[model samples]
Target chain A: MSSQDYWKANLKLLSVLLFVWFIISFGFGIIFSEFLDQFSLGGFKLGFWFAQQGSIYGFVILIFVYVIAMHFLEKKIGIKEEENE
Target chain B: MSSQLLTYIFVGLSFATYIAIAIWSRASSTNEFYVAGKGVNPIANGMATAADWMSAASFISMAGLISFLGKDGAVYLMGWTGGYVLLALLLAPYLRKFGQYTVPDFIGTRYYSKTARLVAVLCLIFISFTYVAGQMRGVGIVFSRFLEVEIQVGVIIGMIVVFFYAVLGGMKGITYTQVAQYCVMIFAYLVPAIFISILITGNPIPQLGFGDTLVNSSTYLLDKLDQLSIDLGFSAYTENTKSNIDIFCITAALMFGTAGLPHVIVRFFTVPRVSDARKSAGYALVFIAFLYTTAPAVAAFSRVNFIESIQEKSYLDSPDWFKNWENIGLIAWQDKNDDGLINYSAGKPFEGSRPIFSDEFGSQGQREIKNLPTLDNSNEVYIDRDIMVLANPEIAKLPAWLWL
Candidate 1:
């Protein structure tokens, strides 16, 4: 990939991951929390669960996914750190 | 051993460990002082970063805040942790690639403006000083409660201990000491939670224990909590009390603020590679999630346990824990209508008439009872929410070993 293509791919990846983040934290966790609470998970309402623990778990998973995805992307684009050195 | 003696021994030993680490890891040059010689393992840096990020407020007030806020407390849980996502995705790798010693350094060179650098420095100083003041106050609170000294004396002792290690070892010393602190703080936070979880829900793992059925009851834990809250005239535990707009604003602001915090961002600079910086953020969240997840469990269990143990009891018949907290001015009770019963509820005091409690009267016990709008004049209990977590074990009657 050219340098411009590499940068574009990176930005696209960020946007996708960030979109998931926004939905989990602000969307389900807050705006639709009451609606989600109509369902139950164990003793927790689905919405309440999303707000308290689900969003946090989602964040942790999201970051690691970004890390792994970026590692693969770097190799495919021939922009790995070793190549630069 | 007596609890006070145990406290002295544990606190003294932790202080010694910190000072010893300072001596062993003393920084001889600016590189070591600023960035731990840039040789720290990602895992070790992650633990240190976790320790640095989990400040006094996280340690002392977070669970207490959550316990009172109920479902509304999700703002903090999501806000604080969600910011790490922003940091990892948007800032950490790029800042690591930039390879600067400080945030201002990165901003100055990137923006190409000396004026921008100076402004960044000023903003950094202001934010750091305000944050340090809260941390110092947290130190004093822990000392005064555990060591039995006045808050001022506790603060002085804390300053002296910090000066020895922080001034001597700089970032190098702090990094190692923080790893140790992470162990102690997490242990201190988790042990009681495990014990309480087992006591209330018959499960040792607090996360699962929170959802488990209450001991000796068929009802699930959250169901019991919702009922208890309503019985006490408080909102249901699972109900959302905050407006969607307010919650969104607060959570978003905290997420952005956590990502932008200077101290937290600086932790990325200590790692060896940009890749390691990414992994370090992941590992740090893992460590932080251990406490963040458990804290809600602690809050839920404590709120349920407190109501079961204390509600509807007469002041004269209250437990020793209640009296102990009262001595510290954290719990108060007045008979109001001369009925001698404590009525805890969620509405405005005396229907918003604001009857001054005896403590607020200040040497004149002549406040008119008739002027207060209380139903039967029995609205006289004031309990500071900070006491909720610290007093949890005592209220639950957990073993003394977990008290520390």
Candidate 2:
């Protein structure tokens, strides 16, 4: 419930979110792309999907998840703006 | 069978969809017009933000730039998208919590000085206009090629279309309409990528095609491209040729600039909660990456296709695609070897001042024309690399539907 605790929780979430970001962009884009490309889904190779569409889709989903996660965190940490009755 | 007709149909469809969305979601109040009543769903906001962020530069220009730059071009890839990290961590949440209608409002309020607000406005106007000029140029090119109209007419049409809804919807109108634009732009971008990837690598995804070995060749596609580039006096395609200092500075500037951009920063303000702003920043990057990641693939595939298939071939022997782009002044060459074939070279700008004529006035003012080098340098004129993306689908002989 303390300010310190709220900061800790948000930082944790951000770190995790950034990890996913790295996996999609750097992992699939440059490093592990060749290995991933050996696999195919639909008409797209895995690496190609990650580069062109998948990473982007993952990014959108992550942000929305962060929003929902923040709501719970806000309630726990006492920063929730009062909803209009 | 009808490439020209298909372009008209697709462009017409996109225009219709955008206008319909604008009319249906027309903003009644300044608040609604600017921020969509501050009630947009986060996912929808993400899509709208993506459209707003991508611009004509991303949709139409980046690939062409990358195709030419080869590995040195990663600055754009890393510079443009990496800024979202700064936005999410440093800027978006605070701006959202403060909650303002415009970026200038935030700077004015946060810094707590009216001078700051005025300065912010001036900076915003300058940056926005610079970017808008690029978009207007892009629209003119797209219109001129696809519709067989003059570039001036195309520019006028684009300005009118953008003005109609931009003025009517304000921010709110722009937001909703942007979501539709995002769909059109992404589809226009990806469909061609998918087809080209298949044609070249037998891989449907472009990102993988970069790493995948060429479809029938023993060499990896990237390796093959690097070889082709070296053969033609270009640095290897995948090698980093830029100074690390230049790369570092450009990357940092692009990251900060992306975060600093007034329009992108404004998108976060529309969200209802501080957390939503952070989330939206992340979402916006994801949406943007769709185009960003695919662009390199488009550039690489098209580059290999052009060099291997079109460049240096005789005028009579060149594919129909080359002749078409050449006529539009988008592609050009000279047989430098005098072998009756195009020999590509980077040409220098001529030393004399040639007058440029403007359509707005028969003789508005005399602006010195800089005759930059063309791709083939046969004529001593330069072809701007931006033309590549616009002309690529045509040059690659992809189906007409892919052009839209």
Candidate 3:
């Protein structure tokens, strides 16, 4: 991929992941919590679960996902760190 | 051995370990001091980052805050952790690419202004001192409670111990010492949690245990907690109390603040490669999530345990932990209406009537609520939320090892 294409792809990936990040932490966890609370996950209210633990789990997974994605992207774009270093 | 003696031994051992690491890894040059010669393993750096990020507040006060705040506390839970996403995605790799020693150095060079660098330095100093003040206070509180020393003496001991390690090792020493600290702190945090999880919900993992049914009851733990909260006139544990806007603002502020913290950002720069920096952030979040996820469970468990153990009990009949905390001024009780039973309710006990105790009494002072000639004496008990986490193992009657 061209350098510009690589940058664009990276931005797109970031936006998609960040959007997920917003929905999990702020959307489901906060704004729609009462609505989500109507459902139960295991013994926790779904909303409460999202707010307390679900969001945090989501964040951890999100970062690792981003890391893996970037690694793949770097290879695909021929921007490998070893080459640059 | 007595818990106090055990505390002394454990604390002494940990201090020795930190000092030993400092001596062993003492920086030979400024580069080693600043960035560990930029040779740290990503995972090790991640653990050190976790230790640096999860300060005394996360270890001691977070669950306590969540216990009292309930749903309102999710702001902290999400805010603190979610920032890692921003850091990992937006800042870490790029900053690693830039490869600067300090945040101010990056700001100075990137902005291409000496003025910007000076401003960054000033801000860094201000923020760091404020954080250090909190950590010092936390150290003192822990020492005073566990070591049974005066707060000032505790502060002095903490300063001396810190001075030895910090002066001896610098960043290289701190990196490895912090890795050890991460292990010790995480173990300290999780052991009690695992024990309490099993005791309360029969689930070994606190994260899952929080959602499991209470061991003796058919009802879900959260369901039972919600009922208990209502019984005590507090909001349901699952109920959201703060305005959505307030929660949003607070969460946003905390998330951004976590990302913007100079010390944390600097941790990313210490890794060998930009790719490693990305991986390190992931690992840091993973380590952090262990405590972050478990803290809410601890909060819920402690809140329910605290209410069940103390509420409506006669002041004279209060548990030893309650009295212990009271002696430390973290808990206080007054028999409002001259009834020996303590009335622990949600909100300020004296909202409508003039408080028998002056507001000037502050946090630590004991206010005599007796013989208030002017107002109806309805206010009864005052408990600082901080005591909840420290005294939790005791309140739940966990084994002595978990208490330490």
Every candidate's lDDT: 0.82, 0.71, 0.85
Cα lDDT for residue B105, candidate 2: 90
Off by over 4 Å in 3: A82-85, B349-379
Local accuracy of candidate 3 as per-residue lDDT tens digits, B1-404: 68778877988899999989999999999888888888888899989999998977788788999999899999999999999999999999998898789988998999999999999999999988988887887777787787677668878887887877888897889999999999999998899999999999999999999999999889998889988888777788888888999999999999998998888888887788899999999999999999999999999999889888988787667788877766665566655566667777765554434333443332223344332332443446667666677899999999787778
Question: Where does candidate 1 chain B have its weakest 10-residue lDDT segment?
Answer: B362-371
Which residue pairs come into collision in candidate 2? B33-B172, B334-B378, B372-B382, B373-B381, B373-B382, B374-B381, B374-B382, B374-B383
Weakest 10 consecutive residues of candidate 2 chain B by summed lDDT: B359-368
Mind giving the per-residue lDDT tens digits that candidate 2 earns over B1-404? Answer: 47666767777888888888778878898778777777776667878888987887887788989888876576677667866776776688887777678888988988999999999899999999998998898878777777667678878888888898787767777888898888878887888888888888888977666667767876678767777787767786765567656655776687689878888888877777666677777767777877887898899988887776755666567677665655555544433344655455333323323313222311211121334333433432335577778777776788666675
Top candidate, metric lDDT: 3
- Candidate ordering by lDDT (highest first): 3, 1, 2
CAPRI quality band, candidate 2: incorrect
Error of 2 at A52 (Å): 11
lDDT of 2: 0.71
